[model samples]
Target: MIIIQLNQRQQKIIEIVKENQPITSENIASMLNVTRATLRSDLAILTMTGILDARPKVGYFYTGVNQINLLGNDIKEKKVEDMMGMPVVVKKDVSLYDVIVEMFLSDVGSIFIIDDQENLCGVVSRKDLLKATIGGLDINKMPIGMIMTRTPNVVTVKREDSIVLAARKIIEHEIDSIPVVDMDDEHNVTKVIGRISKTNITKLFLEIAGE
Candidate 1:
């Protein structure tokens, strides 16, 4: 990949995000007295360089690139189980509308779906819900199971897995989160115990850098 040096505008963008974090692209452009179209490439470069964090429906925030290297060495061997957040689960038979309410209440991207056995069966993402709701389907009575990405297709990590591996899987899959699971060899299924998300990893980096 060709290296593109950070220009003065990019630097100013970083400073802007640092001060007024979670600022939208429109706002950032207005601050710089430019159109969002003019700022797009610059914003793209900054984010691609790990200098800024962009969240959909949210906005841009500085990821503290300077401190990222501080935790680079320490993060490789960290265990995901120690850092993963509590799993958010919903019964497969639960109404899609109910799941949507829970998703907003919990502020999570993906919600794990379980059967009567409470074993991990599927995963439903915010995108999935949005797409489902865009059309006038009876979501009030629609079951989440009908729309979920069934397991075996779901990417996951074990509690004992390294944080590096979890990070890799997340990047490779381009998913918002991965369920930390426990295997049931006898039953040949996985149980969702926790979830490791981009937010969790970001916090882990910040904590490590602080330490």
Candidate 2:
């Protein structure tokens, strides 16, 4: 069987259908506090994915089993590189002011810091810049490297690592983004190749659900 992962809203829809089989789309929308039109796309996706079966004059019915377990296994087996976004990077010697500007221009929550040779050195987040501002430090004169979360302390993931592991690192460390790194034979970070964020994970879930 081809197992497809469902998002939270999709799972909720399945639950409602299971409990109240043959329920009309109008009633389902009312129960979920959404417009029937709003649910049209979701319904279409579920039906097309074979997760739900809709009958004329009847309602929606659940047709799959062990969906949650299968989804969990699928996520565990997925690789980080497949879902990672391009990394936004800055030189370690970049001015603190410039770093903040780069973060805004790139529209990323975090930025990777690299050295003259383009080696991974550190990472800076919006929170870090905020703290620096609140501290009344000179943003223009200070180099971002001085305030960045340095290597050995930065939480990173290998491109080939499981996405599940990367997700755990995000949750455990309370970070918004993680740098996907390539390492040398000795396991030292050699390059900042990509990034994985909560948004990336959400997009992956949506894609799996055929949305």
Candidate 3:
């Protein structure tokens, strides 16, 4: 169930091709007052989605398939690795103040802590920091390791995991984000590479809604 809410140009392209079957891309571009390069991606998307049929040396033909916006299949196929953002990682030995500073600078709700081997060892969230602050802990003197939620207690997602799986973990753990990790089977450790958060999933939902 792939959803394709056609934009104005795409719909217009469909109409143009519908009116003039077997029309060349060059003529379509001239009709739309845009360059062939500008319509290249749109044409490609249309053809791939079965909205338009293209023939080499010929032109485009309307397939009589209107835009469909069901989003299930595409969403289900999305993986965490491709969608995850660069993670904000700091050494476990770093001061709590340094971690806080980095978190603010990066504008992330959570920060991943790495060990000397650069493997993920712990995670800290804004609520965790706040709790530490409330406990009268001195951020300047405290090591991030002391406050982090250490693994294997920390929740994580593999690069091959589906976005749906990642979203489920976030909801279950009630955390803002989860690290995208690669497991070292021989060493029994995981290395953090990326992160997925509510914001990312929200954007995906918005796209699905065609809003």
Best by TM-score: 3
Error (Å) of candidate 3 at residue 143 is 0.1
Cα lDDT tens digits, model 2, 101-205, are 999999999999999878898999999999998899999999999999998899999999998899899999999999999889576537999999999988877
Clashes of each: 0, 0, 0
Off by over 4 Å in 3: 2-71
| Steric clash pairs (candidate 2) | none
Q: Give me candidate 1's TM-score against the actual structure.
A: 0.64
User: Order of candidates by TM-score, top first?
Assistant: 3, 2, 1
Backbone clash pairs for candidate 3 read none
- Candidate 3 per-residue lDDT, tens place, 78-177, comes to 9998789999999999998899899899999999999998999999999999899889999999999998999989999999999999999999999999
lDDT of 1 by residue, 64-166 (tens): 8773453344466789888999999999999999999999999999999999988899999999999999978789999999999997798999999998899
- Candidate 3, overall lDDT? 0.91
For lDDT, the strongest prediction is 3
Question: lDDT (0-100) at residue 33 of candidate 2?
Answer: 99
lDDT on C-alpha atoms for all candidate structures: 0.90, 0.89, 0.91
Better of 2 and 3 by lDDT: 3
**Location of the lowest summed lDDT over 10 successive residues in candidate 3:** 65-74
- What TM-score quantifies how close candidate 2 is to the native fold? 0.66
